[model samples]
Target: MKKYLLLLLIGSSFLTACAQDQFQRTSKGTMYKNFTNNTGDRIKVGDIVTINAIQKTDKDSILYSSYKGAPIKVQVQAEGDMMDVLPLLTLKDSAMIKVPTDSLFKDPHAQRPAFFPKGSSLIILLHVEKIQSLQEAMAEREADAAKKQADEVTLVDKYVADHKLTVITTASGLKYKVVQAGIKPKPIAGDSVYVNYVGHTLEGKIFDTSYEQVAKSAGLQQIGREYEPLKFVLGQQGIIPGWQEGILLLNEGSKATLIIPSKLAYGDKAAGPDIPPYSTLVFDIELVKVVRSKAAAPAAATKKPAAKRTTKKKTTTKKTTVATKKQQ
Candidate 1:
């Protein structure tokens, strides 16, 4: 009786291993295995599907994981791609997909990723989280954006009140407070202005500055960088809207604080590792000089080429906090 039971246990273990190795091939020749076959509604074309996914090589080395951050939301496509397999998965379903490296690098001219070598397969482990219709997805996105914008406004307002700042609110929602008044000549559109500025997040973490001491204090000092006032033409498309509008209210030698909302800055996109998406920025700005455009400049200055903007050296600094798109 003991021998018969031992043989039966061995047989069951063998069958289980064989079943685990079996994978189904799709019409497009992709190999897949479903671990949990749920009866819930399966994904469909145009459906926004949220899933937690882990991408790895055949060797089981993980390349990327949505679990570390946020689950991925993808709009299902008709056919012709790995995403086509999404239609087979229902909510809460878990599956494994194997894609041949050769198929991924089909173009002979294309270079294959070093991790996924020739003859290897890229594996994807997926867990379906949620599924929504196209209309539902759009509505949810809008609702989320509105909530985020409202929350940002609340934070900004609180920051202003906590700091006991008396600010002038602009029509576009920017807030500024003059610390010290300067001369009578304020800058206008098309004027080349040189300004020294220090920028930080709402939490008071400095991200960028034109002053060497400020950068050193914030631990953001870049080697071989020449810390100097940033120069840019007012009303230019390259600079952030907040700086363009706020700087117009200040004159040479004037010092002020500008509290910029994300919409006036980077908006939904993160500036760099330091500045997250939807961040509210604060800047201490000092207008050093202003040179009017030729149209606005005195006649004698018009003969000279509009003072060409030049850089002292090639700085390795990443332009995360500068007003200009490429760092003013």
Candidate 2:
């Protein structure tokens, strides 16, 4: 009985090896193996194909998978690349394609990406979800976008109503209300401003705050992170568009609640794990201080070419703080 079991295991391993060796190569040298043989129409050039894709390295480490999000929609082309294999697939078909890294980075002058080392093959597992005309795909996408925009507006409205808040809506769709009005002399572009703010989603879930106590209360405290007033130049592109626009309405010592739409916030892209795509952000902000800009001074008779100023945008939503110093 033991001898028979060993023979069965060996036979299964051999069959698996033979199956893996059945991959066929395309004219461009892309190797692919189809798991399904559907009799439906094959994908063609100019056809918009929706597919669920899983990208991995030859070591079987997953790089990305559409299962976690929406499937991708792409129009097929005559390009001799890995996408060339799409033409051989039909709707509802499943397949695997392997592309060499050397072919992907064929430019000898360019340095290859560190993740994709030389002689490594990028593997792709694909499932064709749908095939449609370009017109149909565009119409569908537009409808989806319209629905999402309406949904976001409904969510923001409900949150405001539930909190019993009155907001002043702006022409650009920003809704804000001055809780404590400040004196005149509001900050303008090119001015340095300091602020303490608490940012949350429409659901009232706090994602970030400049106050250390707030972070502790929300269980968001990070070790070695100093929670203090955030300092940045007003009109700098480092912050979101909503924050930039809403801050302009407040003067030093003013406190306001800004309810920003997703379009003015992160839009369709998710910011980290806490802020999801199409999220409507609510910020309680206090304008601590504002320093006037030197550029706003009256131009001198011999104006040296105004030096171009460039600021690097912060990639993350978390605010950075500077060490507190005695104000001169």
Candidate 3:
């Protein structure tokens, strides 16, 4: 029985060697046709290559290809097998590599299949584009950061100039702003502010609002319905910092113009499609009402109600404290 098992193993090994020989090139004075990856140059282990190749069957039908920008950078790990065609690429040399799907990913605790497709197989055709060095990658990232800062500054300047936005501090205190006398009112920290705001881009494109939010929550999607007042707790991070800070300046019925810097708006990331990357915002905000919550004042005091009568004369002092420090 052991002799029979040894013979079976030897036969299987011979068949595996024969199957591998199909992928090799033979040279009898170049008479045999050699299947070279005629697309790009050979790839190496450490080179980061971009591929726009597709998988297909033995009859050559394509499955997928990169349709967007330049090719992607494939980072090679320090250990394990790094695909089959790593030995066939050079720097800036583009080539196609066919990788088996079973060899792509491996997980032990998975359900259903063992390998990628059980008895089936798949292929990944790759093209070696360019190799990225650590220094080169860092430098490129730093350059992008610098460009973003310059853009944000430029956008802020343009917004301020075009909108004629003013930033005058007010005697009413409480994050003050002056817009058409008595039109804007000061709000306390704990007030629930209902604001009708239209946020616009540099080209006067409104991207978001409270009306849109209510309509969206109600399953309505029309643009006209998206223009409504949104109610939120003041000083909370529910909206951007610009919105929070700007709204705190308005009295219960104030209409104010707020020109926000990109840092205060979306920070580093781009907002909605209308708000481009590194964009400054202009908001025309109208304060609807200051929601007076019964529990808003007692959040920090924690004193007895009968003792509160002794501090009745200090109501304005308590309101001032709520305006400044806040409970947080």
Summed backbone clashes in each candidate are 0, 0, 13
Error of 2 at 242 (Å): 2.0
Q: Model 3, stretches more than 4 Å misplaced? A: 1-66, 69-90, 97-125, 128-130, 163-185, 211-227, 293-328
**230-290: candidate 2 lDDT, tens digit per residue:** 9999877889989899999898889999999999999988899888878899999999989
lDDT of 1 by residue, 1-328 (tens): 4533443343334335534677787777778877679998888888999987777776656688776678899888876545768888899887777788888898999988888788988777778889999999999988988888899999999999899999999998899999999985998988899999999988788999999998998899999999999999998788999999999999778999999999999998899988887888999999999997888454562233334444444575443332223322
Q: What is the full ranking by TM-score, best candidate first?
A: 1, 2, 3
Against the hidden reference, what TM-scores do the models get? Answer: 0.82, 0.73, 0.56
Which sections of candidate 2 miss by over 4 Å? 1-21, 55-64, 99-123, 295-328
Higher-lDDT candidate of 2 and 3: 2
Question: Which candidate number has the best lDDT?
Answer: 2
Q: Which residue pairs show backbone clashes in model 2?
A: none
TM-score of 1: 0.82
Which of the numbered candidates is closest to the native, going by highest TM-score? 1
Cand. 3 TM to true fold: 0.56
**Model 1 per-residue lDDT at 256:** 98
Total residue pair clashes for candidate 1: 0
**Cα lDDT, model 2, residue 99:** 80
